[model samples]
Target chain A: MEVAEKTWGLMKKKVLVIEDNADHQAIIKSSLVSRNYLVVCADNPSDALHYLLDEKIDLIILDLWLPEMDGLSFLKDLKNVPEFSEIPVIVTSGTFGSEYDILKLNGYGVREFFMKPYDPAELVETVGSLLKKTVD
Target chain B: MFYYTDPKRGRDMKRQKRVFLIGLLAAILGYLWELYLIHSHPPFIFVKIKPTWWMQWVILFAAWRIGVFISGLWKTQPTASSQKENDREEELKYLSRIYQDLSNSLRLEKGKFEAVLRGAPDGIFTLDEVGRINFWNESMEKLTELKKEDVLGKPYEDVLTFYSTGKLVGFEQGTMEGSSSSEPRQAVNFFSFNGDQSLSFLEIDAEVSGGKEFPAAVSVSTLKSPDKKNTEQIIITVKDMTAQKEIEKLREEMIAMITHDLRSPLSSILGYAGLLQNPKLCVSEEDRQKFLTALIRSGKGMLLLINNLLETARLGDGKVPVISEPVKIKMVLEEVAENLLALAKGKNLSLSVEAKDNLWADSDKDKLHEILTNLVSNAIKFSRSGEAVKITAFEKAQEVVISISDSGPGIRAEEKEYLFEKFSKIKKQGSTTGLGLYIVKKLTDKINGRIVVESQEAIGSTFTLKLPASKKASSSVQLSLVGSR
Candidate 1:
C-alpha cells in the first residue's frame, strides 16, 4: 500500500469540469485542487471538447444544462470517440432530476450522478475512489 | 247476479203491455157483437156460424198481439250497421286525443333542447344525415358570425372550412367511414363517425367568415337509430383553442424559466456555504470574505425573486392599497441610491442623484421607494463598468418628473413595447428573473403615475416617471420665495 501511495503521488490524476455557472466552477475547482488533484475548468461544451483534445483527462464532472450544446449530446459525442469512451464521467444537474434522464445517463456509462447543492466532500471522495480503481 | 236495465227497453215493455190489454178488450167486444148479430138476424146461416165467428174474433186479437210484440222487439234492439258506425266514431275520438298529447310533448321537448343548446358555452350545431346544417345554436352564430337562418338547410362544407397542416380538410357525409381514392385519406382520418355514440375530438384550424382563421378543437358525436345501421344526426361542438394553446405555452415557458432562475442562485449559495464549512481546506482571510459576500448575494437574489413572485400574485388581485402622502423626492432618491451602492460598486458603476432641496411629490412613500430602487438597480445591472447611472428630479407644471438614466445598451424600437411586460427580458444577461420591470410598471401604475422611455440603441436609455406634485407644499414655497423677493 505504501508503494501504491508512492506511485499515486508520482502521478496526479487530471479531472475536467464542464459547468456554465462561474461560482460552481470556482467552488468545484477549489475543492479538487485542495485534494491534490489537477482540475481543468470549461464554461461550455465546445471549450470542454477543446480541453479534451489537448489533454488526457482521467475523469470528467459534467453539468447537464449548457449554453450551446446540452451536456447529454456532448456526452454522446464523447462516448463515440474511441479514446474518450473509457474515461469515467460524473454527471451533475441543477434542474434535471427525472428518472428518464438518470437512466439515459446510466446507459451512457456514467460513474456517478449528483444533484445540485451536493456535498463537495463526497464529490472529492468519489473522484478519488474512481481514479484509484482506474489506476489499479 | 247484477242485472242492468236500460230506460229505453223499460219504455218499450210498458208500451207492449198496453197493446196486449187493448187487444184482449177488442176480442171481448168482437165476441159480444157476433152473438148480438146471431140473435137479431135469426136466419138459418147466421145461427150455424155464430160460435165460429166469435172464434175468428179471438184469432184476430191474438194476431194483433203478436204483431205488437214483434214491433216492440225491433224498436228495442240495434241493427248491425248502426253498431259498427258508433264504434268507428269512438275510435276516431280516442285517436285524436292521443295525437294531441304526442304533439304537445314533442313541442315541449323541442323547446327544452333549443334552450340548452342556446345556453351552452361552446359552439354547438347538428347536421342532418345528408350533411346539411339542421340546427345551429346561439354560440355557433357568435363563433362564425353567421345567423341561424343563413346557415339552416345549407351544406356544412360550404359555410365552415377546416385546415390541418396548411391543407384543406374535406368534411362530407359518411366521410368518417374513410375517404375515397380521389380524396386525401389523411385529412379525413381525424373524423371517427362509425354510427357509434362515442365522441372524437380533433384539433384543426377553422376558417370563419371573411377568411379569418383560428385554432379550434372540434368534437363530433353521431346519433344513430336503434339498429345502429344509419347515422341519424351528427352533433358537433367547437371550442376556440387559441387562448388555451397560448396559455399552455406560457405555462411551460414560465416553469422552465422559474426552475432555472431559482436553482441557479440556490446552487451558488450551497456551493459557497460548502466551501466555508470545509475544515481541512485552508481558506485565506480575503478569500473567506469573498465567499461570504457571494453567499449573501445569492441569498438576497433568491429572496428578491421569491418576493417578486408573491408581489405579482398580490398585484394580480388588484388590491394593493395606496397611502398617499407628501414624500420628499430627494430623500427617496438618496435612500434608493444608498441601497444599491454596493451593487453598483461591484460592477464599478457610479450612482448619482440630482434633485432640488425639498422636492416633494404626493405619492405612496413605500411604493415610490420600491419603484426607485428597482429602476436604479436595473440601471446599475445593465450599465457597463466605469459608466454612470444618473437620477434626476424636477417639476413640470403640476407634476414631478423623475428620470433614471443609465449608460447601458439601449433597447431597440420594436423591443421597447414589451419592456415592462411580465417574463419579458430583452437580453438574457446575468441572473435576472425578468420580473423587475414588470413589478416596477405595476407599482408605478398603482401610484397613479405615468412612465415613459427614451432610448437610442448602442447609446443609453432613460426611464422617466411623472407623478403629481405636492400642491400645499409648493404653494407655501412659492409664498416664501415671493416674500424673500
Candidate 2:
C-alpha cells in the first residue's frame, strides 16, 4: 500500500496559478484539485517566483495584470531560468487578446491563450490536454 | 522758380506797379506846377524858384528820378517780407504731403498686422510698457468674451488670470497700478524657467470672464527695444487645450474600461458562475455558497461601474435632473453604510457613523446617498484590515457638514490636486475605476454643495461635504436646474 500511494503521488501533475483575483484563483484551484492535480497559487510575480524556486511545477497558469510585475515580464524571467524554462505556460488575460499579443505569446512558446469570460470546463480540458502532451 | 509762380509774389509786383504809378503822377503834378510858374506865376515867386527854362527842366527830371528811387525802395522792403511768407507756405505744404504719405503706408502695415493677428487660431494679445493691454486679437475676444473696446488699456491681470501647474503665474504684484518693471521681469522669469530659450509653450489654466476656466498652452515672447536691454512689450499667445484634453481623457477612459474596469469584474463573474454550473466537478455545498457570493459581488460591481459610466455621460451632457428636497442626514448616511457593509466586511474594516440629533440637509436624497456611498466605499477600499471608517455629520452655521474619514494609506500631497479629476488614479490596483471621486464631486456640485478633502501621507484622509441646512426660510430658495435637459 505504501508503494501504491507513492506511485499515485508521483503520477499527479502540479500546476502553479499566478493570479491576483481571489475568485479566479479559487475556481481554477477547485477545478484542478477535483481532477486529482496539485495546485499552488500566488497573487504576484515575486511570490510566483518563490513558488517556482521551491517546487517542481509541471504546468503554469499566468494572469496578465498582476500587482508587482506583469505576467509577460515574469514569463520572460521564467524562460531565462534553465530550471523553470521547460515548464509549459497557459496565459489568461482580462484584456481582449489582440493578434499581436497572441503572436508574441506563441513566440514565447505559450501552450494556450484564454481571454477572460472564458468557460471553466474548456480551461480544465485544455489544462488536462496540455499536461498530457507535456508528459508524452 | 517758386518766386515766379507764387501768388503772393504776383500780388507784390502789382503793389510795386501801383506805387510807381503814384510816384509818376506826383512827379508830373510837380512838373506841371513848375510849368505854370514858368508861364504865369507871380513875378516874385518866379524870381525865387527858377532862373532859366533849362534849369527848370533839369529840376523836374531830377525830381522824377528821386520819386522813382523812393518807389523802388518801398517795393523792395515789401518784397522781402512777402518772400519770407511765401517760403514758409511752401515749406508747410511740402511737410504736410510727406506726412500724408507716411501715415498712409503706416495704416496699411497696421491693417496687415491686425489681420494676421485676428485670423490666427491662437489667442494673441500685447502688454504695453505700462503693463496695459494695448492690442487684443479676435481670438482673444472670442476666448474671453470681452470686446477690444472694453479690454483695451485695461490691466492684463484684471482681464484674465493665468495659472501654471495650479499656481497663479504670468502677472506680477502691483501690475494693475502700472508697475512697469515688475511685469516684464515676471514674464521673462516665467518663460526662461520653462525653457532655455526665451520663447516656449507653457501649459497653463486660463480663467476667462464669468469665472469660466479652461486649459491653455501659453507662449511668451518679449518685443525688445533696439538696444535689447529693456523689454518694450510682452506678447502672449494662448492655444485652447480643451479639445486636446478631452481627446486624451476619452482615450484613457476607453483603455481603462476595456482593460480593467469592465473586463475584470466580468472575468470574475464568468469564472465563478461557470464553476458553479459545472456538475462534473465535485463542488461542495460550502464551496457552492462561496462561488455564488463571489458571482453576486462581481455582478454588483459591474452594475455599479456601468451606472457610474452612464451617470458620468449624463452629467457631462448636463441632462441629469436635480429635485432638491429636505432629507435627514443621519438616515442617508446609514443607508450608504448599509449598502457598503458587505464591502467593508470583506476587507475586515468596521464602518461607523456619528451625527447630531435631528440632523437635516436641503439636498436630493438619492444624490446624497450616491455621494456618501462612493466616499465610504473608497475609504473602505484604501483602508487596512481592522482600521475603522468613520462618517460624521453635524449642524454648523446654518449648514449640514458631513465628513468621511479613513485610516488608510493617505494620499500624497502631490496627488491631491488631481484626486477628483477624471481617471486620475494615484494607486492603480485591483478593479478601481478611478471614477468614483470624480462622480461624487460632480454630483455634489450639481446639488449646490461643496466637497473638500484633507489628507496626510501614511496617516489618513477626510472628505468633508457641506450642504445648506433644512430650514423654512430656505424652502423658497430654488436651485437653478440649468444643467437638466
Candidate 3:
C-alpha cells in the first residue's frame, strides 16, 4: 500500500531545495532530479520569497538556517501570507534539539523536522507521501 | 609522703618510733642475760662467758640487729599502705587517659566530619535526643550563630537554633521527640535560608534520625576513621543550591537568547522557501526552479546546523535522556545513505553501501542516526566530483562497526586530532557551521560508542564507529578505553 501510494504520489510532484552553498545546492538539485521532482532552488530568503510569491508550490522543504532571513522567519512570514497559509512546511536543518529553537519553530507551525545531511530517499518518500495526503 | 601531710599519720609514726627504741633496749638486756647464763652453765652444757667489752660489743651488735629488724618492719608497713593508695591512683589515671582520648578523638572526628558537613553545598545540623546540641560543628555555629557552649546543655526547645532567611528559626511542639527504633520517624522540615547574599532558597532533605532511638536527628551518616571504629551518626549535608538554582534561571534566559538567534534565520529561510514555492507568484520557469531549489536546500542546511547546536548543547548540559533500544545498523545506514544519495549523485560521485547484513546493536536510535549521518555527509562534502563514498556496516566480534569511506583529501594529521572539536571546521571559509562532526561525536559518546577517524593527506578518509552490542557493554568498553588510553 505504501509503495503504491508513493509511486502514484511521485507523479508531477514538486520539491524545493533551500541551501546557501553552491556545492550543496548542486547536490540537492541532482538528487531531486533523479527522483523526478520538479526541483526549485533558492540561495537565500529574498530569492526564495520571490519564488514563493510566484509559484504553485506543492511542498516546502525548508532549511532552518539561511542567509539574511532564516528558514524559521521565512516560515513565520509564509504562515502570515494569505496565499501560502495552508501550505505544509517541513523544517530541515543540522541544528536541532535546542530547547529554545525547536519550541520557536514548533510554535510557528512547522510540521516535521529532519536533520541535515538527511536521507535522500526518505526526503523523496516523505515529500511524496505528504503531497499525496494533501491530494487525498 | 602523703601521710606527711596528715597530722594523724605523723603522730602515729612518732609513737611507732618510740616503741621501736624501747624494743631495742629490751632486746639488748635479754642478750646480756643470755650471755651471763651461758658462762655459768654446768660441764654438760659446756658454755663460755665473754668479758665486759665483749658483752658491750654483743649489746651493740644486738642493738644493730634490732635496729635493722625494726627498720625492715617499718619499711614493710609503709609499702603495704602505699600499695592500696597506688592501686586507687592508677585506676584514676586510667580513667583520665580514657577521658582525654575520647575527647581528642571526638574533637578530631567531629573536626573532619564537620569540615565536610560545613563545606557541603547544603545546610546541615544535629539535634540531641532532647533536641539539645551535643555536638555542633563549625557549620552549625556559622549557620545558627549559637556557640556550642551556649546551646550544648540547653533543651531542644530552649537552645534550638535555626536560621531561615538569616533569621533564627523557631521550633514547634513535637519537633524534639526522639524517634522509636521500630518505626523510625525523621521529622523532615524544609526551611528557607535567608541571607543577604543570593543564598536564600528552600532546601529539601529528611531529618536523618528521628527523636526516638536515633535521636539527635543527625542526618544518619557513618564516621569511618582509622583511630575510631565505624560508627553511625546523623550527618546532614546540604548546599545552598540557591546559586545553582539561580544558574538554572540564568540558563533559561541564555536559552532564550540562543532560541532567538536560531529561530531568526531558520524561520526566514523556511518562510522565503514557502513564498517562492507558491505558483501564484508567476515566476519564470528557470528562475522559479532555481529559487525553490535554493530555498529547500538552505532550509534543510539551516535546520541541520540548528539540530547540531541543539544536540551538542543538550549533551553538554547532561540533560539528554538516553533510551537504549535494539538498533539495526543497516536501517540507519540505509536511511543516511539514501538521504545523501542525491547529494553524492549531484557531484557525480558514487555513493555505495556495503552494509548487506542486518547488524543490530543496543543504542539510542536517534543518537546513532546522528553519528552515521554526520560521518556520511562529511564524506560527501569533502569529496571531489566523480569520487566515490562508501558506507559499510558490519559486526566484528562484540562490536558493530559503521565506517564511512570517502575519496576526498584525507584530514591532515594535525587537524584530525581536533576534527571533532566544536566549531573546528576543515572548510576554512564557507557557510558551514562546523558543528556536524562534533555533534556526531557527542551523540556517539552518549550512546557509549567509540569513533575512530583515519585520514591521510590527499588520500581518502574513513570514519569508523564502534559501539557495543549492549548499552552496558558499551559503557564498560568506553570506561576501559578511557582508562587504557
Error of 1 at B428 (Å): 0.6
How well is each residue in B202-234 modelled by candidate 2, as lDDT tens digits? 786788756688888988877767876556788
Candidate 2 residue pairs in clash (backbone atoms < 3 Å)? none
TM-score of 3: 0.35
Q: What is the lDDT of residue B302 in candidate 1?
A: 77
lDDT of 1 by residue, A45-64 (tens): 88999999999899999998
Superior by TM-score: candidate 1 or candidate 2:
1
Off by over 4 Å in 3: A1-20, A23-136, B1-287, B345-348, B470-485
In every candidate, what fraction of the native interface contacts is reproduced? 0.49, 0.75, 0.02
Highest TM-score scorer:
1
On DockQ, the leading prediction is 2
Q: After superposition, how far is residue B297 of candidate 1 from its true place, in Å?
A: 1.7
Q: Could you give the interface RMSD of each candidate, to one decimal?
A: 2.1, 1.8, 11.6
Model 3, B16-66: lDDT tens digits are 554566566657765666666656545224344444767666766676567
Winner of 1 and 3 under DockQ:
1
